[model samples]
Target: MSTTPDRVALVLGGSGGIGRAVSERLAADGMAVAVHYAGNKGRAEEVVTAIDAAGGAAIAVGGDVADENDMRAAFEAVETAFGGVDVVVNTAGILILKPIAEFDLDDLDRMHRTNIRGTFVVAREAANRVRAGGAVVNFSTSVTRLQMPTYGGYVASKAAVEGMTLILARELRGRDVTVNAVAPGPTATPLFLDGKDEATIANLAKAAPLERIGRPEDIAEAVSYLAGPARWVNGQVLFTNGGIA
Candidate 1:
């Protein structure tokens, strides 16, 4: 509740299911949002329009998060429009599922390009440009703990994010900025539900004590906490999975 109306957030992957939820949640909480998309300008624009319709401030930005130049321009655009960037929520990622023995190296390469390289690209930008008293939220996954089959490649990328995020939190010493990651379990988003049959989905839903998969808004609530009221929290990977772990 200490958040102000002027704080600005650049939500990378803001066009996707979970990312859209994060963007809207941040805007609703009073921050002007720059909804960043990789290749979907229209999807990003839709989020911006929704925020505008809700009487909140928002704009859409485009970039490949794995590219440093693109991300730098993204930060510059946000700073120019909003005067400064205070929060960065990177919900951007790629998830490819296949058994490790059968996984293609090219798939791993592609996933790492976005899920790992892309995350750090934005992290570096936020560290250099985010104003004081800002927040940086990275995304992780509960599957890193679940050790689920066919998730090895995807989990590897997120685990890297978890490591880099914890280290970055300490590296930002004296900057008064908080860095953290949220790990959600089997969220019912396109990212999590795609390519799965009903039986697989049902099994995942029952894996959690909550007896259901997470909602995008459920995960967004955790990001809102880290990005807004939970200043004392830092350098941690929060498992926002409804006790799936």
Candidate 2:
């Protein structure tokens, strides 16, 4: 709890499992927040309501993360409501898991469009609109390092995100903006647990030294650091996976 009462943050995919955690966490730290949802305005509004119930300021925004025009409007809406945006966190992405051989080309294209293209679209707006001393936090996956099977497509998309984040940090030189990506291991989110059974879950949980999977709050804490006081930690991928490496 330290508070940045004057700051503002826009969290893409703020309605989802991990994204909701980040949105609420940022709000708890006194940043006015815009919760961006892909299509579920109701879910996004629920997160906003929760933040407001907790004495925080938040609003729901909706857009196609991969669409340039849609993302541009999202930035405009936040700027209009909050005066300026200080942190832009992109957690809006798609995950399609299949072996490269079994993956449909269309699925690969869709995943890249949302995960890779969406990240850059948000970054493009943040590059011009985020205030000085702000941060752009993108989401990646620990599977990129873990090299898990059946995750080739998903990992490819996130790997692109890692590269994009690193280069964006360097490109923002002299702008006082820190660009970074958070790569989280298997977290107990609905998305992660959908097709998994107890045995598989147990195995993943034990893969890390902590003897458990990550929590959304755990990942949010890393994002909170990058968005707040970690000024020198730029151009890097912080794998917040409880020593899974």
Candidate 3:
């Protein structure tokens, strides 16, 4: 693992399940964390409270990742609080599931705006601002590989992230910064498992070789690994699923 004693980390979408988990993990690993949320100030504050309770340094900020001005301001907030950013984790996204024929154009635009454009906004900023030996981690999903029905638009958006990650990694060569993505399968998060019946959830779990759905912590573990220990890993889309795909 490569680490600077006083490095800072920024997590976009830090109020959601996977984002919150990653924020806590990085803070535990000794980085001051700036937790960014899109809408829920309360949820973002909750994550900061948890980190503070655990004796880790963290603060909450709000921004819409798709907006460049908002993202720039969020970075400014992080830099002001913790010096400068060394790690950036983007987990902000929206999922609207429907068959293609029934898909709403409005929903499609919203998903693309957040998932694809937001990723670029953050990545572009990180590429220029992150210090030497910093890391940038983007989020993708296993559904891109699973090709599940009714996920065409969502998967398509994430696929753009995957492509961008590879190009960014190459572009950052010799900068001593690693860029990568984590793709988790069917995690047990509010966004993922909120309304499913027990039987349906269990069946989905059984489909994986691990016979259980993933936890936010499971995905967080992967992010921590890449952000800290996996210095040689770059331009990779790590599938953090339990061999389901």
Query: What digit string (tens of lDDT, one per residue) describes model 3 on residues 176-212?
Result: 9999999999999988987789999999899999899
For candidate 2, the per-residue lDDT at 100 reads 90
Error of 2 at 68 (Å): 0.6
Off by over 4 Å in 2: 1-5
Q: Model 3 off-target regions past 4 Å?
A: 1-5
- Residue pairs in steric clash, candidate 1? none
Model 3, residue 205: what's the lDDT? 95
Candidate 2 lDDT, 89-195, residue by residue in tens: 99998888888989999999999999999999999999998899999999999998898889999998898999999999999999999999999999988998998
Local distance difference test values of all predictions, in order: 0.93, 0.93, 0.93
Q: Candidate 2: worst 10 consecutive residues by lDDT?
A: 1-10
Per-residue alpha-carbon lDDT of candidate 1 for residues 1-245, written as tens digits (9 for 90 to 100): 22235699999999899999999999899899999998889999999999999888998999999999999999998887888999999999988889999999999999999999999999999999988899999999998998988999999999999999999999999999999999988899976777889999999888889899899999899999999999999999999998989
Candidate 1 local accuracy as lDDT? 0.93
What's the TM-score of every candidate structure?
A: 0.97, 0.97, 0.97
